[model samples]
Target: MRARNKPWADDYLKEHDEVVVQAPFDNKNKWQDFFGNDQPIHVEIGTGKGQFIVGMAEQFPEVNFIGIEVAKSIIVSAVQKSLDSGQKNIRLINVNAEDLRDLFGENEIDKIYLNFSDPWPKSRHEKRRLTYHTFLEQYQHVLKHDGEIVFKTDNRGLFEYSLVSFSKFGMELDEVLLDLHAYEDPKNVMTEYEEKFSAKGQSIHRCRAHFPHRN
Candidate 1:
């Protein structure tokens, strides 16, 4: 579903330029310097409303969190959340994650989170899925040789397909949970979508995968 247009989104973004990084592309290859820390950077693609990223920032202050949200309506809320958290380890980028390499340098990103991404169930639209082979390759371009992709979804079909896709790419499946909440892992940060849907008894599927070492 498309996000409802927020008329004031543009104004809000401009007002909070500090949190809503205005020129993310220019920061490519320089994210660590931007953070002014040697701590690892973790990225959340399709970050909706900022819940997961903000929560993670607070939980793991040792890590830097970058959220890439495409919807202007949604990113504004993320920016506000970061401000409220009073955490300096978080940054928001109002842009699509279609081509991560454009915003990150090779071997720059340490980890990526694909939280409740669109399932894109139709076979014809498989390539559009965030976990699609094409998308995985794009991730490889920017992630370190040992970097990991953490994917979560409520759609069973997409979960199954992604698991197979990861294997086909020779990516190691470090972890796979058919019913994530059943584990009740303390480290799992809930996205707004995950909270709403899981409340209705929708099981969340999750996995951690690593690309083949390019070295």
Candidate 2:
């Protein structure tokens, strides 16, 4: 289901530009300065509503969390949630994934998260998938050496396709979980989409992939 448009979304974002950036490119390499600390930075590409990012911030207060979402309405909600959570370590950007390289400098990010992303099942639309090779290349460029991508989804087809994409790109999987809910990991944070799917007996697939180390 698509998210309904919120009439107040724009005003909401303007009011909270501190949490959701109005011009993320301006902060490109100054992310640590934005957070007022030099802590490790973690990003979530498709941050639907900031649940996972806020939870992670609460758990790991030592890291800074940045969430990027394209939908204005959705990102507005995320900004509100982050503010309500009172986690000073959280920040959000309303921008598409394609703008990633333009927003962060090389080796700037320590880790990235992709939770319950769109599968984009059609073959012709494969390039639109977040795990596409081009997207992985951008990820590698921005991610620090040894940084990892943590992905989760209920779509089996996307999961399988992503696994192949990762391997083909010469990336290696550090961990793979066929049934994330069953794995019962204490550190795993569930997005709203994941909780809904898991309640319907869906098996959540998750993996940690990393680009090869520099020579």
Runs in model 2 lying further than 4 Å from the true structure: none
Report the Cα lDDT for residue 203, model 2. Answer: 98
Q: Count the backbone clashes (under 3 Å) in each candidate.
A: 0, 0
**What is candidate 1's local distance difference test score?**
0.92
Q: Model 2 TM-score?
A: 0.97
Top lDDT model: 1
Q: All candidates: CA RMSD in angstroms?
A: 1.0, 1.0
Task: State the displacement of the C-alpha of residue 210, model 2, in Å, after optimal TM-score superposition.
Answer: 0.7
TM-score of predicted structure 1: 0.97
**Candidate 2 C-alpha error for residue 192, in Å:** 0.2
